[model samples]
Target: MRYFLPSKRLGFLLLALLLCGFALNFFMQAASLNMDAMSVFSWIGEYYWLYLAGGLFFFFLLLVFSMILPSVYAGSAVAAVLCIVLGIVDYKKLSTTGEPLFPWDLMLLKNAGEMSHITKGMIPPLALAAAVLLIAAVVWLLFKLPKIKVSLPLRMLFAALSVAMITGFVSMVAHQSSLAVSMKYQNIFWNQKVNYKQNGLLFAFAGNLRQSLIEEPEGYSRRAIEEIAAKYSKLPDPVPNVQATQQPNILFMMDEAFFDPTRLPGLSFSEDPLKFIHEEESATPSGFLLSPEFGGNTANIEFEALTGMSMYFLNDGSIPYQQKIVKMSSLPSIVSILKERGYRALALHPYDETFYNRNRVYPILGFDAFTSEKDLDNAGRITPEGYISDKAAVQEALRELKASSDPAFLHLVTMQNHFPFTKGHNGPNTISVEGTSPSYKDELETYTQNTKLTDEALAYLQQELLTLDRPTIAVFWGDHLPALSAGIYTDAGWDSEPRLKHETKLVMLANFNIGKEPLNTLSPAFLGPTVFRLSGQPMPPYYKLLGKVQDEMPGLSKQVLIGSNGALTAFTPEQQQLLDDYRMVEYDLLEGENYSQDLLF
Candidate 1:
């Protein structure tokens, strides 16, 4: 009759505690607009066992801890309750607006200004009641257990061990998918729905398990994984030869909200942002990049630029950063290639490394060093919009460049001009568009200001390199076009598909040495070969495979512009075959299929 034994009372008490934990966690999740059961359930089917284990373990751990360290348990319980209550308050605002929440959206809770004004103050009491009930259940079970049957030390040890095992298991799955379900099922709404359905427990449990392994269409993918790995395998060949000669220092820059200056109304510049970067520095450039995404996905650009793989090849609407369904090479592989050739490779982003899972993916890609917001000591200098100034990034680059003994390959991504164009937003760095064309003023202003800042930084950098004893190469290009507001889209006669037009862009750029020649234009897709040529590395078979086509019909070689022309239309057949071939090869490689026939081509 001991409560600690496998009795009905013990099971009921454990279930009560689990339900309370689930409700609290659910409310926290449902507080954001980007979250909901659907987003949470996306991972449930893939890792249900882990979720169940976490609940059981956490319950036992807390129980043991409460006995051993009552004060600590009291503080933790208070904090947990507060977090849940705050989440409830936030959810009240969004629920009113009919906006849903996602599991990984707790970051949005910190955005104080976006919170809804309505103060219904409804759910806190109910949440408190549930918490009280759980506490009561636990207390009742303790009292019911016979003191002689269960040793205090044994009870405590069992709880602690369960907690430790559960915590470790949950941590492993959180990165995979079970974290989503654990958060959602914690909510009363989702739990109620599962209970209402026939065989709801089995169905919900299976769904949760499915989520952990499945690819995240909106966040990350297996195809992207393989693509990244493949890009690394094809890293600029002739490593030793490239290292023998005094190779120029390489600088990779990604400018925010950048588009073809050729598309801009006024293109004159006293100081060119990327005038010197060119092919004679040994160049290979593509026509149209045909990026699979636009507006918000800077990760796709990173994936493409580093992996030399196209997002267009994967399932549409998949995000490669969040999920790891496929394994692929990354910029780090290029870093490794350079490392072999006595070069130092580094990744620089003027933002939080955690934003796009850069912290997780950067090392896998092969970079020796990563510099992010944490690396910047002066946090105040960073923009209010959660981004460090590109100028700061350049400063750090200069410092890092001076310290490195070997030729360096640096990846620098800038974020100054990211959309929402409003004057006075970024302090002294703001570009004034008051006198410019009123129609495109807001949109143009942000780009002009950000571009101007980037230009100034580059001009200073060029001068800095002049002081450097060794030769250097700086490659700079726009990540994507500016994100125009809805007003401009509507005003500019965009009725049917405004999102598509805004997405269209020119992504090719100058691949110049300190003072080298420049190509008239090229596509972003051609960058891999272009990098190989610039670095004096051997082109793999595929680069040559596409290189001949570019040579024969240079006009037809643009990466993304094949939709309009007759010859281009005819070439689609060949392109599709190439895509299929590449896809199968990529998949096979991910599946660990070893091939004697090199697929490097």
Candidate 2:
């Protein structure tokens, strides 16, 4: 059947859209492939169908937007620049933090100074130049060329067709329709890094777009929340509150990317890199913390620690700061809990206030004050590479503590030991370990030196706390393991012994002797309750419930569920009940109605 013909032939416009579509796709994938032209070309050759999938989606988007202006070259040019820029930004993000760009990450753009900061990392000069010159020249040349005129009616028709086709394509990906199934597109929801590599970036992004629809726990209702709340309400206080003459000053100093380098499998240094930490751990209550996040997403670990909530139940690849907490009216956290008893809660981080929306979010979390990079007097007290050192963060916390008379819940987050681990960033590298990997020697040395400095800073904080006449308690821990540019962790057995990648030490030091003992490993969610119990603070029903769960499920997460025997084991029926109750309560607080916020928290 012949459709209605256009008044005049629309020549070369369709071809232009097709060429621009695939070209834009190549540049975008180049970033994810680490600007390796060889790898990008090889991937195109191997995953020909997947390449076409992303390209076709881009083509439809360009077609629809271009039709709005009804100019062929002009529309494609706008689309091309946006796509190329996205590629550059994604490249920088992956290289710097080991995290890829997601669809919802667009919300992070609201934070000022983010764009300039993201564009600053270790981007290769040739790749950046070639991407700019080649694509820019092509786009500029296209813009200068003669316009292929199509009537408004024909443009509208084309736009409608493009919308329908792309909508169908997206629907297929989201719903896993038969056609998409036939194409064998694996979403890889469990591992986002692999998802982007395996399914192509666009397909993986579309997969995440559907994650806004949160799943409800089985038989979720107000009744379920109340039932859980009732159980905790009847339960006895895990540790009764003491009639302390004075409330102790509590400091949670979370060091950036700090870990025991001596513990790494398949490699070692000449001596212990964290000598100070080792000595302190033997004297205090210290053990490993099973950090939910690995290389980056420090905010998530902070969320779990500050709030007695598990990231295990939340959506995969989701950042609570960006996705959940920022939107909520008030989140029940350690800060809020401590503030009820006249404790002054303050947050300290030597990075941008807007890095994780902490500037606005901290107030919502009930922080009395937040001191960030801009707020500091010596904000530039940093390494040569400009990452604010751990020393500066600890000093700021000490100053805040000294100034306040009320028991302060100071949440100190360090920014040293962050990426681009250039050799001698801190000072001379001491090979404290016995061996080394051939691939990541320079980075390993730089990272080792950084850890030594972190240990020293932490020791310094503890020594200062001891001098204070007032009773004081402090907990220091690592947020996550440092990620190297070589990306050799998986090869070096991070995957085989998954705990090694997630494992980080947790130490609790106090001026008063509260019977310190070593902990094998525990989840960040349990840290607040542990501190409360140790410090003789009044325990709320919600915290009491968490304490109970931790007794059974220590260091538990979606991936790592440790058994009583210290090995990964299947869930028992009793364990299943505990898990379900935990999920229901978390859902009630986070996503569902706050039915029992008062009753529980």
Best by lDDT: 2
User: Please, what's the RMSD in Å of model 2?
Assistant: 4.1
Looking at model 2, the pairs that clash are 268-433, 268-434, 268-435, 269-432, 269-433, 269-434, 270-432, 270-433, 271-432
Query: CA lDDT of 128 in candidate 1?
Result: 67
Error of 2 at 359 (Å): 1.6
| Tens digit of per-residue lDDT, candidate 2, span 1-601 | 1233443334466666777798888877887888888887888887787788888888888888787775677776777778777777777667756667887678767763644553344666787798779877877787678756766677778889999988888888888777776666777776777777767677777777776423678899888888888988898765533445689899998888888877766776766778888888887788999999777889989999998889888866778787778888898888988899899999998877887788878998999898887787565444454577787778778889989988899998887787657676666787644356555787787788888888878888878888887788889889988766535675566656778878898998887875567777989999988888777887888887888788888878866877656865777787788888888888888888878678787
**What does the lDDT read for residue 483 in candidate 2?**
69
Q: Give the TM-score of candidate 1.
A: 0.54
Q: List candidate 2 stretches off by more than 4 Å.
A: 1-10, 22-55, 64-71, 84-100, 110-121, 143-200, 240-243, 266-271, 427-434, 437-439
Best by TM-score: 2
lDDT of each: 0.49, 0.78
Residue 210 in model 1: lDDT: 20
In model 1, where do residues sit more than 4 Å from their true spots? 1-244, 260-290, 325-332, 379-386, 428-444, 493-525, 542-567, 570-573, 589-601
Instruction: Please provide, for model 1 over 1-601, each residue's C-alpha lDDT reduced to its tens digit, 9 standing for 90 to 100.
Output: 2433544544454465556555444434334423466644544354445345534444554444443443433423544455555555445434332222223233334433322211112345687699789878756655665432234554566567756765564444434345535444331222223221211222232333323211222323445435534754554443321342566677777767665433333334333333432212233232333334445557767765665544544433234554442234433234555666787889988666775577767776778899986787773343465356667777788788878888888888877666445554455434344433476675455555566666666656656767765566566666655555444444445435422333333322322332233333333445555666655666655554334333332222212334332224345565554544444443443323324024453
Cα shift from native, residue 468, model 2 (Å): 2.1
| Cα TM-score per model | 0.54, 0.86
